[model samples]
Target: MFRFAVLLLALLFAAPAATQSLQAQYEAFLEGTIWPQAKLAGVSRKTFDGAMGAKRLNTDIPGLVTPGAKEPPRRMRQAEFSAPAKYFNERNIGYITATGRSLARKYASTLASIEKTYGVPARILLAIWGRESGFGRVDIPHDAFQVLGTKAFMSTRPELFRRELINALVIVQLGHASPSAMRSSWAGAMGQPQFLPSSYLQYAVDFDGNGHPDIWNSVPDTLASIAAYLKASGWVPGRDWGFEVTVPASVSCALEGPDRGKRISDWAKLGIRRVSGKPFPEHEARAEGFLLMPAGRHGPAFIATPNFYVIKEYNESDLYALFVGHAGDRIQWGDSRFSAGWDRTDSMLRSDIAKMQRALEGKGYDVGGADGLPGFKTRRSIGDWQEKNGRTPTCWPSNALISAIR
Candidate 1:
C-alpha cells in the first residue's frame, strides 16, 4: 500500500499540469481580449485580419535597459550613450526629418484646420507625429492584445497592461478599430500618434468629419487626433514650451528640479537670461516653471512650464521631451543651439553606472544602487559633489567620480 501511494504521488509531481507555461497562458489571454477590441475600433475587417496574422510578441526585447552588465575589457565606458547616436547617424536624422516634412505636407490642410480649431501649435503636433512613428517609418511590431498580454505576463507592470488590454477591448467594442488592425509597439501604444488604447478613447478625433477616427491610415485623422490630444492636455495655444536660458555662474544647476519651480518673473530676477539675449516676452513670461539642465552644466538649459509636463505625458523620458521641444524649435528655426552646453563625450556604460550608483549608495546617499543606470537622484548626487568640490557641476560622472567614494 505504501509503495502504491508513493508511485501515485511521483506521477502527480512529474506532470504538474495546473500551472500553465507563461507562453501558453499568454496566448489564451490574447485570444480572449483581442477580438472584442477589434470590432469596436472600426478597423476595416481586412486590416484587422492582416494585422492579426502579422502579430507576435517581441520575446527578445530586454527590459530596455542594461544596468550592471560587466564592462568589456579595453573599452571607453562613455561609448554607451554615444554609440546609439553614431549608429542612428545624420542620414537617419535626415530621413526622419524628411519623413516628418512629407507627412506634415500630406496633412497640411488638416493640420492647418486642426490648428485653427484647436489652439494647439501645428509644429508641436507634427513633432509628436515625427517622433512616434518616424512619420510612419517604423513598423508596427505587434498587435495590441499580444503585446500587452505578453508584457502583462512577463513584467512587474501587470496592472498597467491589464488595464490597457481592457481599453483595447473597449476600442473594438466601440467601433474605433478592430482587434487585428490595432497594431502598435511591444508596449501596446498604437496608431501614428502612439496613443495607448485608453488615450485614444478619450482624445482621438474624427477631424475630417469622416465619422471615424482613422489614425492608422488617414493622414488628416492622425494629425488632427494629435492636435486634439495636445489641446486636451492643456496646450496654451501660442505659448512657447520653454526657452533656452543662460544661468549666472553663481547659480547651481542642482537646484533645478520640479520642486524649485518659480514664476518667469522670479526667473528673470535670478539672472536666467534667454539664449535670444532678451527677456522672454510671450505667454506670461511670468508663468511658473522649473529649470532643466539635461547633462548638468554640459548641456543646454531651459525654463520649462507645467505644460511641458503635459508633453511628457506623451512620452516620459527627459531626453524625449527635450528632443521634442528642440525639434519643435527646429521646425520653426533651423538647428538652433542649446544654451546649457553639451558634454559631446559618450555616456558611461551600464556597469560603470551601476558601480557609480553603488558608490553613491555606500555613502548614505539613498540612491537605489546598481540597478542598471543612473537617474535623476544619481545625477543630483553628482551635482552635489561637484558644488562641494568647486567643480563645474556638469553632473556627468568622470574619473574624479571614483574618488571620495562615501
Candidate 2:
C-alpha cells in the first residue's frame, strides 16, 4: 500500500515535469527553426515575436505526431468508406439553400458586382459562402498562431504547417490583420471562405472598399475572396458547373475522369441524356464535358464541365463540388433533389480499400498511391480490371471485388 501511494505521487509529478520539458523544447523550436525561416520570408522579428509569444503546443490537434514517440498505426483501418448520401443531408441542404436565397436578396448589389467583376455567378458564390462557414454564422474559434505553431512544430505534415505559420506571421507584418483579430478553424483555415494563410495572402480581397481584407466579419470580403479564388482556379465565364445525367448502359463507367473529357455534343450522340429531360444547352454543346460518377453506378452521375473541376479546386472531393453545385441550383431555383437516389452498399474499411489499391498497383494499375480513398484513378482502375476479367464494371470497391483483386 505504501509503495503504491509513492508510485502514484511520482507519476503525478513526473507528468507535469515531462510536459514542461516538451513545452521548453517547443519554445526553442520556435526560436531556432521557425524564426530563421520566418525572417527569410520577410516577416519582421517584432511581428513574429508578437504572434508567437505565449503560444503553446496544442497537443489535441488532429493528425499530430509527438516529438519522439512512435506514431501509432493510422486509424484508417477502423474507418468505413461508406456511401456519400449523408454528405447531402436534406435538413442541412434545406437550411443552406433557404439561407443562401435570403442572403442573395440581402446582398443583391454586392453579389451582382462580384459576379460581373469575377465572372462567377452570385448563386455559386453564395453556395460556397454558406458551405464554408454557414454564410459566416459558424464559429471559427481557434487562434491562427497556436494552431499553425503546434502543427508546424510537431504534426505529421510539419513542412506544410511551417510554411503556413510563416505566411501567418507575414499576414500580421503586412498590417493586414492583427494577431488577436486572426481567428481560424482547427486546421488554420482563416475566416468565412476557410482559406489557409497562403490562400489568404494570394486570394483574399478588400471588396467593400474597407482597405483591408477582413474575411471574418465582412460579408463582401468573404464572398469576393471566394470568387477571386475560383476565378484564379480557372472558373469559365458563363459556364454552368455540371448537369446530372443518365449515362446509358453502353457507356462504360471506366470512361469517367477529367482526362477522358468529350465534347458535350459528342456525349449527347453517345446516348447520355439530361436527367431533367432537357437538351444540353446550345452554348454548352461545343464545350468539353467530363464524366463524373461519384458513387460508381450506385448514385447520381454528371456531365461535368471544366467549371466543375474549377469548383473542385476549392475543395478536391467530387461530393463537395456536387453539393455546392446542387445547393446553388436549389438556392436559385427552389428546392429540388437529385434525380437518382444513392443506392445502399456494403460498408468497407479504408484499410481493405488500401489492400485492393495495392493489389491493383501490383497488376500495373496506377491507383494513385494507395491512399485508401477511391479517387478517380482507383475507380477507373477497378472498372478496367473488372472489364479485363470478364465481369461487369461497377467502378467501386466491394467485398467481392477486394477478394477477386487479391
Q: How much lDDT does each candidate structure score?
A: 0.67, 0.91
Q: What digit string (tens of lDDT, one per residue) describes model 2 on residues 165-242?
A: 999999999999999989998899999999999999999999999788999999999999999999999999999999
* Candidate that scores best on TM-score: 2
Per-residue lDDT of candidate 1, residues 98-192 (tens digit): 55566667777777888899877667777778778877667888767767655655555655776676677667756777776889886778988
**Model 2: which ten-residue window has the lowest total lDDT?**
72-81
* Model 1: residues with Cα > 4 Å off, grouped in runs: 1-22, 27-58, 64-106, 339-341, 351-377, 389-392, 399-405
Which candidate leads in lDDT? 2
